[model samples]
Target: MRNDVVRLGRLSGERSGDMMHFLSSMRADRYIAGADILVDIAHVLMLDRQKINDRATTRQLLPALLRLHDKGIPEEVFDDRFEDVHAGIESLLIESLGVEAGGRMHMGRSRNDEVVTCIRIRLREDLIAQMTALLKVREVLLTLSENHTESTMPGFTHLQHAQPTTLAHHLLAYEQAFSRDFDRLKEAYARVNQSPLGAAAFASTGYPIDREFTATLLGFDGLVTNTMDAVATRDFALETLADLTIMMANASRLCEELIFWSTSFVKFVIFDDAFCSTSSIMPQKKNPDTAEIMRAKSGSVFGAFSGALVTVKGLPMSYNRDLQELTPNIWRGMDDAGESLRLLADMLASASFDTKRMSEEAGKGFSTATELADSLVRSCGIPFRTAHNIVGRAVQKGDLSLATLEKAAGEVGGGISLAGKGLTQKDIDRMLEVRYSLELRKAPGGPAPEAVIAALGERRKQHHHDAELTRKKQAKLAKAKEHLIAEARRLVA
Candidate 1:
């Protein structure tokens, strides 16, 4: 009791001006918290099992962990006496309890396993948070795609107008990308869900530790079967970054299109100013700064991915100091992914498409040249090659006005039996009706109104199903967390 009072007083005194020092050494805190708790738990379990237990010694040892757990040592308390979090924790234990009681808990564990476990827990928590944010982004995208199901926009090939497509098709392209991201993360969970418990310092503990129980206690799905692999490999972190890199690469490309679309020249859409920004000197500029920044910072996630790869490269490791360098890099990439997805969701929610402008431009710039060529084949019985050549020439020539086009149609053949009984100038006019042309393309995957509506209906059903599944998974995770808190409280009680 006297020692407990003294140690608590010492901790309180060190916390006054040293709070900055402790907060800055955040990794050290994590290590201390992790190592000390594991050691204390092991000691308690061991002492309880001994046949001729030393009551006084057990009494003394219990305080080492209890004191540290209750009142952790401030960073200022250590100068040159400790080497790392492991040493710092043990050294504090010795200072609080006598060395005999403090030293017994170090029997079958190593700081290598301790530090790795801490990172694993941190990663699991972070991944769940990131996945939730990604789900929100996907939900917003789905809503936009449904709302714009029939809104026509010019589809491009080689940056030139090729055909007409609905805005819903464009939005669903991103939904598919995000859906794949979700699957990738879920796949990664199978590997990352394993625990490193009982892998003491690159080797299995000789002590009869319940590794499975501890793993379950930590909410891990299983234990790492090979003890050496548990401490040596950081492939889980690499896999996560690889997934983030691929997903962000796709997102960056989409943001590039958004940047292009929001421009006055294309005028496909206008982003709300709340999701955009103004330049310092340019008075009339509503810069797509949010989208631009998303495109730019997306590269930072890639950079962090490369940085972690380099950190782990060429290291034949049981464990090395270089592995510690990966913590910030892993977390930095995750931060970028989380924030980028949030920004994308907000932009999607607030942006408005200029359907009239998009639809108007959808038919101009010789966009109907394909329709004209098709008419030649279907009506004049001309070979497709000859039809393509004729339309291509007509498009290049300055005499391709609507009036000129009708006159030319008569010269080609006013009443050929190819398309029907009589192909006329009126048929050409009807073919040029943008809505009619689009509606006439009633094939399964075509941009016809019926197809678009059907696709929208299917996607909405999928979204509802996916959203319900996500809700169920979230509920399961919440229940697990509640169980952990209850069990931990029981252990203390």
Candidate 2:
């Protein structure tokens, strides 16, 4: 029975069921199962359009395909006897409609062109979803930035407090990084949106096929052009995983910071209880397990990108069975990235900052020292390097008070007179204040409250622009899908 379905009596060889199952990709089969059905529908529709198949066969074919779509592919569609879902689906089609009608579906395409087109169709939607998730995260960041325009915190370098910056400023930095990620996915979307249908087994079909018509119905932007490259190329899959890795890397950095900020020693921020987990033994432990897991996912995504690149790197291509191994990487990587964005956005939207702790820590490491030096450069005639030396000595000497700073400044000579070349006590008091420290910054991109507010306005504009861009593409795809279904249903009606 199995050999009759899998191979004709014309071939004498038979494989053990164990070997068939071992070589089977049933686990990976479901990812493209729906894609296979859609590809078949589009190809059948195209064949009918080009007069390659009679109207009666197509009329029966379209409604039958839609019924299968409605009921969903059966569990037996993953049966190992067919080797993969593509063959399994064809067997199901043949079973449902019999040989004459079912056999015509494979006339002008191969599993090669069909699978690539399916991957593209599914991946296009996933990328849009990923961007949409990121946009939500970006909105959360913008809201956080707005609420904390003057909320001062210690900004760090090499894990040491380096300067005073607002929580708004720090969050905005991530907002911008993720904006670039949003942009990269948009860019990759353009390339991944092309169709590979009609590239039958690395050669153009002799049949008068309408590649563009199939592309339009499948929601693809255009065709993959060259018949050989269309089916053989895995770069689109590779490009998407690589793009996802970069996005995850950025998320991991934010997650790592959240882990540090939530630590008892820092106490700069606290995760929402829902996003945190308690230790198995320690009842008081509110660990940032969510962030840690997402952070670890960054490495896993990177591995996926690397694994795929190596798989396709040396293959002498038109198409190879080895390409089947690459599909799981794309599917798994996309799943990892999409979930990470959704969870990270949720985790951040409810997070709270310890303003007093952040403010207090902002001053402990002489973070306001730069503002003081800048004051010397402005209020006094001393050169910046001399002012730098004077302030550096004051920081090192632990003479952080108004009175002591005067004495320290007088003692640390750069051969420049301190009598008139440094700030007064009044100036010192203002410069030493963290809020005042933030207010003194007037540079366009500086961490000052007004500057952050201005930057926030600009980012909100960008957020709006990107959201519109996403909506436009989404509308295009939605229309294409509706058009495809409408056309198929039209023929049968």
Candidate 3:
């Protein structure tokens, strides 16, 4: 009999006709058993209700499902037996208990509703975890931005030197990106927080299941409004994947910078030796492969996003097998995104910037042209076009030193004067100050140091608040799971 069971299980795929025979043959001696948590809840409700109250049926089937659940049949058996996890559990229950008793388990719901509910529950927890990791990355960026605000580096346009900006300013740009990402997640969370439990199959169930209560029990904000939409839509998945795609893309941009800055030619950043790789042949090679890998892996995430979109693109107004394939991609993308965020935070936190080198590099390539242009406008009453022409000429001469160029500017341009508006040489000097340049444009969203600092502080605070909220949500999820597990154990025990 053992030899027969082994042979039956190993039957080739060409024996497709024999697959059912294989399954039934293995179950000849031992009955297959499974359980659906929602079904159990429904059974209890049925027993409590006067119309469907059947204690004997509940007693017979509920305990059997619970017993099988305790006996530890592999989860894969459920997948192999029925169309889905929920059905597999029910089939197992029917096999263990009599068909009549098992028939009562599915009181008022379809797998359409149950499957969506289970995925939503699972994904809610996953999204919370992803958000927590994102917050950690944001915190690191914020701290780095604040600390490096004064550390000047060459800002670029078209991959060429454009101006001198604080390393803090550049870091804060990413901080801003992450802040928006966090906001996107908050918006996504609103949609994800809704429960879809009572929308059984494609339509609402007949059971008097209090959806609001189930939603509250599941820590959801409310029940999904429309039954068909609840089961058929994967918008939550799209929103999450979109946000993650954006995040991974942004992170990849940062990685590109890291890789460039760590290169021998630039050497603006020095990554930790631990995060570096070495060339097989080159004796002196210390490659920043960690950052490079991150930069490269972003494409994989985009592919995941594309795969999901294509899967759901032409599907009709109902659930389909195509949607089933989306789960693995979603899971993979989320895992990759979370890991990328974690690695990036660690890399950014420990990496060193060559401040002196950056400052030296900052003044080159005529990066201070805008500063000179502004000086001409504010001091000499020169029109912007005139000032711009004068500054461009000075830059063409390859002299970036403001003092030398200021003298040169005075010598040229018919010896322009700042007599009006009581503008003195000292005021001219003040206008030349980079901090002044940054601070003067302190509109609500300007990159002034003060503004950047304020934004950093606020973002840091919000990050903590968000993280705490996630923790509370996770705790609620755990408590709910505990309640469900306890209830299942009680019935079985």
Candidate 4:
């Protein structure tokens, strides 16, 4: 605490070491240091426009703040000697510009609203990066899907083969999952972009400050509206973490599949030597370390997300020190999810699926019985349950060969239904094949080669549109930052 400040005049400068350490915020505040300076610039500019301070003071403080922004605050500005960046910046300014000229910058704001404002500003950028990272992962997934449109693979349920699906169709599932996550981040950014700068410690300040002007200067979507809610609520923070958790969960699902695919028991996909690591002791051992670590990171993100929720669950209607604890989780969730997603894209780009092995596995586990049952219904006008029962009985006998199916159908009179028709054993043989099963089901979103190709075309279009949107959002931020700097320089001029 500054001994000269009127609010702390009752106390001496000799603060207890442990108490100062407990109250210190400079460590976490470093992440938002730039944001803190920007907040000061916006607020000082607003004060100058509103004439809240004498013209000379506002004029002097604006240039000083701009200078600090251009040439960053001294290291002492972020040193642990201060309680937080707010105090540290103020201390640095008072040291350089004298108290009367520099101190007026805080005339219309409090540290409570100021810190939250900085967090919102910085969090918005992080969320945009998160959205952008998801877009990159989406690109990788779509590329994998497009490349493998005709690549057959065993689609599993309960860890057993249930059907034959193309790799394209399977990869497209995660593309869609991650695409929703990208949308979630986009939505969260809207809330995070609202400005909290002028809320002034849960109430409006008496100073004739222009909240809208400050918001525009800061490139915020708009003011946060309610004074109390602006500083009190951390919902935007919580919502961002929720989006991150969902994204990580989606990535973890892919990681789990990658881990299984790289296993010796599966061998459905092979990782690049870079992505797989050899065991130290084992003569022949390859581990999917990237996938394993990526999968575990989702759990860590969840833990941080839950910790954030618990921290904010029962707080009163205002800022608290507890909110400080929530800030690190935002970085944790974003960093973990963002890096994990990038790693997933890289790991997948260099990986290749075992086309022949996947096809062979697709043939095992009676994967074609469903197709035979459907064929009987379509060609012989047999009810599906009856066909299913016949196939089930035959499957009990042995592998579903054409002879086996023919004898079983005859035993159940499906052959009788088909005997007079033009259907032949050749036709039945074609229907029972795994590739034929996939090729025949050309329904929308099916694993059929044609359907997957069409779906890939559509996903690629969506990905292109989304990627452009992400770029535009980043450009918007850059433009806002540029405008802010230009406006600051003009004010100081």
**lDDT per model vs. reference:** 0.69, 0.86, 0.69, 0.84
Question: What lDDT, from 0 to 1, does candidate 2 have?
Answer: 0.86
Q: Write the residue-wise lDDT of candidate 1 on 272-312 in tens digits.
A: 98988887999888999999999988899999899999999
Best by TM-score: 2
Best-to-worst order by TM-score is 2, 4, 3, 1
**Best candidate, lDDT:** 2
Error of 3 at 108 (Å): 1.8
Clashing pairs in 4: none
Q: Backbone collision count in every prediction?
A: 0, 0, 3, 0
Candidate 2 lDDT tens digits, 1-493: 1223546645557778998887787778788888788888899999998999999889878888888777898888788877888778777777888879877888888888988888898898899999999999999999999998877889888988788999999999999999999999999999999998999999978999999999888888888999999988999889889889989999999999999999999998889899988989998888899999999999889988998999999988699988888888898899999999999999999899999888888876888888888877887767887778788877888765655656666777544555554556777878777877788786898999889999999999999999999999999988987787788888999
Q: Per-residue lDDT for 152 in model 2?
A: 83
Per-residue lDDT of candidate 3, residues 1-493 (tens digit): 0112112345534334355444431231112122245335533544434346465665576566555546765554444333345555556656656457765676666667766666666667678877887888888888888787677678899989887677877887887798787778777877877887777777786667667756765567787889989888988988888988998899999999889888888989999988998988998999999888888778878888899888999999877757776766677787788788889889988999898888778756766668767776766678877677666766667664455455545656556543443556566556555566666645654556776677777777877888888788788877865665566456545
TM-score of 2: 0.95
Candidate 1 lDDT for residue 252: 96
Worst 10 residues of 4 by lDDT: 1-10
**Predictions: Cα RMSD each:** 6.2, 1.9, 6.0, 2.3
